[model samples]
Target: MSALLVRHEANRLGRDIAVGDIHGHFTRLRAALDRARFDPAVDRLFSVGDLVDRGPESEQVLDWLALPWFHAVRGNHEDIAIRYAKGNPVDQTSYIANGGAWFVTQPLARRPVYAEAFARLPLAREIETPAGPVGIVHADSPVRDWSRLVWSLRLWRAARDRAMWSRDRLQGENADGVAGLRALVVGHTPVEDPVVLGNVHHIDTGGWMQDGRFTLLDLATLQAIPPMG
Candidate 1:
């Protein structure tokens, strides 16, 4: 797959929902979808990634990936797993410290399968919505110009890494937002609630944590759907 994937005129017949970092919490995700009345037969779900690690059911990542209605971008945790699977230099200790124990403890033979599957995910995704084109990246965009980043991702390793790992936008609290796009949704930094800095939306509610709430943002409305009890 290309470093960036663009889907134009999507979800014409149904709603498009974008969710925060799942971090292996499938049960919570399912509940949230249920609350939102998500219908896989029509409604499509988009994830900002970090689909594995930090929560129970980490081993079920592959099954989730197989869902036709589910799409995801590559996140930092996935990046670490890919590097380890390729026998490339990776900080094993740090990876384990950051909720990667599930992956580390998996059978060695399974690493490649996970890596290959995750490698097919794009670092960033652009989906066309009625409001405009919305961008989804694991972390932050490389530059303020969303169009430029999309055009350069394949040849720009720096941009790809930034898309998966950078938190500058959140840290600096830059509200200028990206151009050439309606909104950019991301999920590396966990916020108490969905926070919108200009058009960049941070929706990772730390769903992997015991006290965290899994949030599902309506892509068409750019609003958080209140999870049903």
Candidate 2:
């Protein structure tokens, strides 16, 4: 692994909030931030990725990268987009079929730059705060032992891909816990509300749904900040 695979110390600031998959809909992001009275100067926003695709404003999702307070791990959708941008036709087809048709509409020249940026996104984030250390991953945190997972990441092993695409962890009757994590925060599994299984919490509420609101899980408070009306 290299620096890309190891756990780097997190930069803690005022208030740190973890957001579910945005899936584009940049306006909703704004609304959620506004509704929570998010102060960018004094607050921090962490994303679970899927920042683009399937919404009206997919193209604008990249703009969030410019914000100093915004941080994220790569979502599975972002993985596919990175592949497609890197000239992988298989991923292009898969991405388009999975509500990412707009990806093909973007100007070809800009995709390389976008793909480079998206590919550089971390696969996991561990933040140590006054509340304790919170871990964030896009989809699932495959291993129960966080150290084993970190080792796998450093070795560039098979478990790396599983972290971004696996849903089996959320399906079983067993309430498996990720060992050594205070709370493992995940997206990609949309629920009517936040679902807590052992130490794992799923916050992706399918905000694109008609009744959904972009959820911002406040780490300082460990509560979902209300979304816009």
Candidate 3:
């Protein structure tokens, strides 16, 4: 399948922390990690994607991706970079307008490298936690049942697209939560504070914006670590 689904075993040694969309703010991410006292020797960090774009450190995405403790899903911004690098149809104006100017300025030889790395990221991840299975997607969950997510995403293009781009759950008044997963965390749409709609938790606190603070959430407890003072 073009789109991929990955499962991670429970972190028996330490914490499994989930962070919101990075949007190229590696410096802010590092500072937040320090505040959380994250230890790569034991703690693992998971990203909701958008690792590049918007911020000045867009070029440092690869370095962060190479870290063994970092795991991420594919964000829509990454999709734009991938399509452009692969010679697929993309709107250059839209891409540049949405904090992708840095990517367009990258060397021709290096452009494909970003695409290659991002392309490797799975569209959906099911991480086993002490509490239960936590699903991570860039946007919204395509299926109401998490158990069928893997096959649905693999077999249906619509399901894969919704996984990375849909926002229906947030915009609508649906009070129902996805079944099977203890919690589903997403990061594409930014909010002033983390919002929980049923079992889905929206944690994109606009870390890439001038006034926003990155949120570090404890996956097992479903609680956000307070921002550094």
Residue-wise C-alpha lDDT for candidate 2, range 49-112, written one tens digit per residue: 8888888887786678878788888888888888788777655566677778887777999887
Determine which window of 10 residues in candidate 3 has minimal summed lDDT.
1-10
Question: Which pairs of residues have clashing backbones in candidate 2?
Answer: 1-154
Sort all candidates by TM-score, best to worst.
Answer: 3, 1, 2
Error of 3 at 155 (Å): 2.2
lDDT of 3 at 150: 85
Candidate 1 clashing pairs, residues 3+ apart or interchain: none
lDDT scores in order: 0.88, 0.78, 0.90
Q: Candidate 3 on 12-63: residue-level lDDT in tens?
A: 9999999999988999999999988899999999999999888899999999
Among the numbered candidates, top lDDT falls to: 3
lDDT of 1 by residue, 85-187 (tens): 8989888788888888988887999999999999999888888888899999999988788868867777788888898988888889889999988999999
Instruction: Show how many residue pairs clash in every candidate, following the order shown.
Output: 0, 1, 0
Compute each candidate's TM-score over C-alphas. Answer: 0.95, 0.90, 0.96
> Which is the better candidate, 1 or 3, if ranked by TM-score?
3
Candidate 2, residue 224: how far the Cα is off, in Å: 1.6
* Selected candidate, larger TM-score, 2 vs 3: 3
